[model samples]
Each structure stands twice: as C-alpha cells, then as structure tokens.
Target: MVVEKNVSLQRCNTFGIAARAQALVRVRSVADVQDVLADPRLARTPKFVLGGGSNIVLTGDVQALVLKVEIPGVRLVDETDKAWIVEAGAGESWHGLVAWTLQQGWPGLENLALIPGTVGAAPVQNIGAYGVELQDRFHSLDGIDLLTGEAFTLDAAQCAFGYRDSVFKHRAPEAQHGAPRGFGLAGRALITHVRLLLPKAWRPELGYLDLERKRAEASVEHPSAQQIFEWVCQVRRAKLPDPAVVGNAGSFFKNPTVSPEQCQDIIARDPKVVHYPLPDGTIKLAAGWLIDACGWKGKSVGKAGVYDRQALVLVNRGTPQASVSGGEVMTLARAIQTSVYERFGIRLEPEPVVV
Candidate 1:
C-alpha cells in the first residue's frame, strides 16, 4: 500500500468542499489495512477512515492519516427459505448495491435508493430514506479495530440502531451511556464487510406522501420493488438538487422528535404544522417545513445557501474555484438551527459529520 502525501479532497465529498489530506492510503483489500497497521511509523499516526465522502463537512485540511476504503465485492452469502443474505465489501456504493440487489431479484432495499454514500458509511449513520432504515435490512458487519488491529463482528441489535445513529457514530465514553465499552466503533474501527438479510416475503413500504402521490399518478395501488425504486429516484430528483450538478449532502438536518405536549403547543399556535406520531408516542416534526416557515429557502449565507426546492438541503452556491468553505456552510447551518429553535422551541440536529 503506497501512502500519498497532500491529497486533494474536493472530488472526494458530495459537497465538493476543498480540503487536503496530509497523508492518504487506499485500502483495496484487507491486507492493505493490515499493512497499514503493521507499519511501525504509519501505525503510530491517528487515522481517519474515509468512505464515499458523501456525508461529511471538512472544516480544514485533515491532519490524521486518511485510510480510504476501496474493498469491492458483492455476492449471496446464503439463502434460506425465509430470506437472502447478501454480503458486500465496504467500498461498494450504497445506491449501486441497492440497484444490484433489485436486479438480482431481491425485492427489499428499494425505498433507500439514491442515498449517496458507501456501504461502510451506511451503518455509521444508520442511513434512512423514505420509510426504510439500514437497520431494518441489516444482518451483521465485520470491522477491524484501528488500534488493536483486531477484527470483530456485530449484529443489528448489537449496533444499537437509533434514528440516524449507531454505535459507529459515538465515541466509547459518550456511547457508553447504555451500550458496552467495545460497543462504540466511531473513530475506532474500519468496516470491511456488511451482510444484509432481505426477506423472501418483502412488502412494499409506501407510507410516504411522495410515494402515494406517485401511485396515484401512475394509477397503481401495489407497485413492484423496481417500480418503487424508480418512483423514489424520480421523487428525489425533483425534490433534491443533484449532488453532481449542485453540491449537497441530501437532508441537512434530522427531523426532530418532540413530546406530545410540545407538539400540542405547536399545533395550537399553528395548526398547519406538519407532524407525525411516532410508535413511541413522540411526534416527529417536518424540519423542512419549519425552515421554510422561518423563511430560509433559497437564502444564501456567504457561498452557502438553502435549496429553493427543499429547505432541508443546504447547497454550495459558488463555482468549484470559489466553492463554499466549511465555515460558511456551518455558519448557515447554525443560523438555520438558531432560527428554527427560536421560533419553534426545538433544536435541530445536523445530519452531516463536521470534520
């Protein structure tokens, strides 16, 4: 494994944020990772595991030795009468894997189409789109400890999947609030493989309003998995700016959940406030609606701006040569957060990792 110095990261992330890595290594195989760990000088440096770079905001040049995962493969690990266990290398594109599964006649994972990231990063954020989350289809994953060079595996429950959260998102101490010590994998492990269990009797998840509207437009009540996948892509293309054409990291904030009393108070003040009752009796508020109501859509803060179509998305308004800086992006994000919090008495949590 050759280590390169001063690597440009503008094309690495969906945001197209200009940044550089002091040193970077590409791990296309497990042996490459082993080589990195085995090296005396390299092994001593703090490392950063970079995936597709779709879900991060780089504040400045990365000082840690960057390990770019590029392991690649997809195969059926096993198939029971009940489900199909599909395994993929961590470096595979998340959307590509979803499409590949559908082409292979696996019906599940259609709802999570067009999520721009690598398979390795999916579980880190517990990525969810439409009505589906990664934990729903997750079986198990294998990762190598950065420090000890020890390999490990974890099941769905062991990951402690919460709303857009997992053990991979927290440090050991902060993550120890409920889970065990070795449980938190954030900044500690590099995922190598992920196995997904797709059920045989998969049912379509069309609870989202956009999907239902597509159903009406197409005049079909029950759609196939492929059809649902197409619908999701179509809906996303219309609602969200293409990261390729316009830099963005999909949804910029998590949909905040509130108590029933808080929901009632908001509802009383503005009855049109969009919300849904969660299974746990908490109410999930539409963050996009709150941002739009607060008059932030299409507004620019320096070179960072809110998308005109969807307020949940923040975009880089400058050209590649004059792209938005990480500080500008965070400034706009903080302003939006402050406004939403002040108006609704609810704090909005950022979705992207700020590095």
Candidate 2:
C-alpha cells in the first residue's frame, strides 16, 4: 500500500468542492488496513474514512489521514428457499451492486436503483429510495476496528438501524473504559464487506407517488423488479442532476417526521402542506415543499445554490477552478435551515457529513 501527500479531493466528493487531503491512503484489502496500523508514525495519526464521497461536504483541507476505500468484489454467497444472500466488497459501487443482483435474478434491490455512493457508506446512512431502505435488504457486514485493529462482523440487529441512521454514524464512548448503550461504530470502524439478503418471493415496491404515476401511465397492473429499477433510474435522472455534470449531494436534508397532532396543526393553517403517514402513525413532511414554499429554490449564496429542479438538493454553481467552498455550502445550508425553521417551526437536518 502506498500513502500519498497533499492529494486534491475536489473530484473525490460529489459536490466537486475544492479541498485536499494532507495524507491519503487507498485501502484495497485487510492487509492494507493492517499495514496502516503497523506503521508507527502513520498509525498514530488521526484518520478519516472516505467511500464514494456522495454524502459529504468538504469545508477545508482534510488534516486527518484519509483512507479512500477502493476494495472490489460482487458475488452470491448463498441461496435458500427464503432468500438469496449476496456479498460485495465495501468499495463496490452501490448502484452497480443493485444492478448486479437483478442480473443474477435477485429482485429485492431494484427499488433503490441509481442512488450514489459506495456499499460501505450505504449502511452508515441506511440509504433509502423509492419506498426501499438499505436496512430492508441488509444481511450482515464485516468491519475492522480502527484503534484496536480487530476485525468483527455484525448482523442487522446489531446495526441499530433507524431512519437514515445506523450505529456506524454514532461515536462509540471513549475507549473500552465504557462503551455506550448503543454500539456506536462512527469513527472507530471501517466496513470491509457487506452481505444482502434478497427475498425469493418478489413483490413490487410502488408506494411512492412517482412510481404510481409511472405505473398508471404505462397501464401496467404488476411490475417486475427490473421494471421498477428502470423506472427509478428514469425518475431520478429527471429529478436529480448527475453529479459528474452538475456537482451536488442528492438530498440536502432528511424529510422531517412529526406527530400526527403537529401535522394537523400545520394542515389547519395551510391545507397545501404535503405529508405522508408512516406505518408508525407519525407524519413525514415534504422538506422540499417547505423549502420551495420559503423561496430557496434557485437561490445562491456564494456559488453554493439550492437546486432549482429539486429544492432538497444543494449544488455547486461555480466553475471547476472556482468551485464552492465548504464554508459557503454550510452557510447556504444554515440559512435554509433558519428560514425553514422560522416559516414552519421545523429545523431541517442536513444529510451530508460536513468535514
């Protein structure tokens, strides 16, 4: 494994923000991680794990040693009457894996097509799209403890999955001195591989409005998983800008969920409020609608602009040489948050990790 100094990270991130990693290492396998830990000087350095860079905003040059995960593999590990288990290396493209599974006749991951980022980062955010979440298909994952150099595996229950959250997103308590009530993996773990359990009995996930519309337009009563996958890709292409062309992190905020009473109160004041009733009876408000209502769409604060097409996305408006800074992005994000809070009494939580 080779470690490089002063590496530019402008292209590494989806936002294409201008920044650099002081020291960077491309981790491909378990041996590379072990080598990093074995080196005395490098081992002592603070570290940061980077996947596909689709869900982060780089505010400045990264000082921590960046481990750019690039491990690669995809295959079926097992199959049964109930489900087919598929395994992928952490650095494998998430969308690629979704497509591969369908090609192999595993139909469960079709609803989450076209979502950006790597497999390792998916569980961290518990990525969801088109009525499907990663946790729904997740089987297990293997990770290496950054500090102790110990390898471990965890099942779905051990992940503590929630709406756009997992143990990997939380900080573990300081040392073995005291682990938290939750198995917070956050900075302490580097995921190496992930296994997905795709169900044998396939059922279409057509709960989202767009999917329903597509189904209606096509006049199809029942759609296959591959069909859903194609529709999702088309819908996303129309709604979301390709990061390679126009720099952006897909959604800037999580759709805030509130109690039914709170939703009713808002509905009373404005009948036009868009909301969805969750299975748990909570109300999920449309964050994009709230932002659009507050007049943030197409607005820019120093090259960091809220996307005109989809208000939930934040984009880079400047040229490649003069890209958006992390501070500018945060400033725009904070302004949007403040405006949404003032107008709706709801604080919009940013989806991307600000570094």
Clashes per model (N, Cα, C within 3 A)? 0, 0
Model 1 accuracy (lDDT, Cα):
0.94
> Would you list the C-alpha lDDT of every candidate in the order shown?
0.94, 0.93
> Would you give me the overall lDDT of model 2?
0.93
Residues 1-355 of candidate 1 have per-residue lDDT tens digits of: 8999999999998998999999999989889999999999998899999999989999899999999998999999999999999999999999999999999999899999999999999999999988899999999999898878998999999889999999888887644465446456788899999999999999999999999999999999789999999999999899999899999888999999999999999999889999988999999999999999999999999999999999999999988998899999999999999999999999999999999
lDDT of 2 by residue, 214-272 (tens): 99999999998888999999999999999999999999899999999999988998799
Off by over 4 Å in 2: 175-182
Top TM-score prediction, candidate number: 2
State in Å the error of residue 331, model 1: 0.4
- For every model shown, what is its TM-score relative to the native structure? 0.97, 0.98
Query: TM-score of the candidate numbered 1?
Result: 0.97
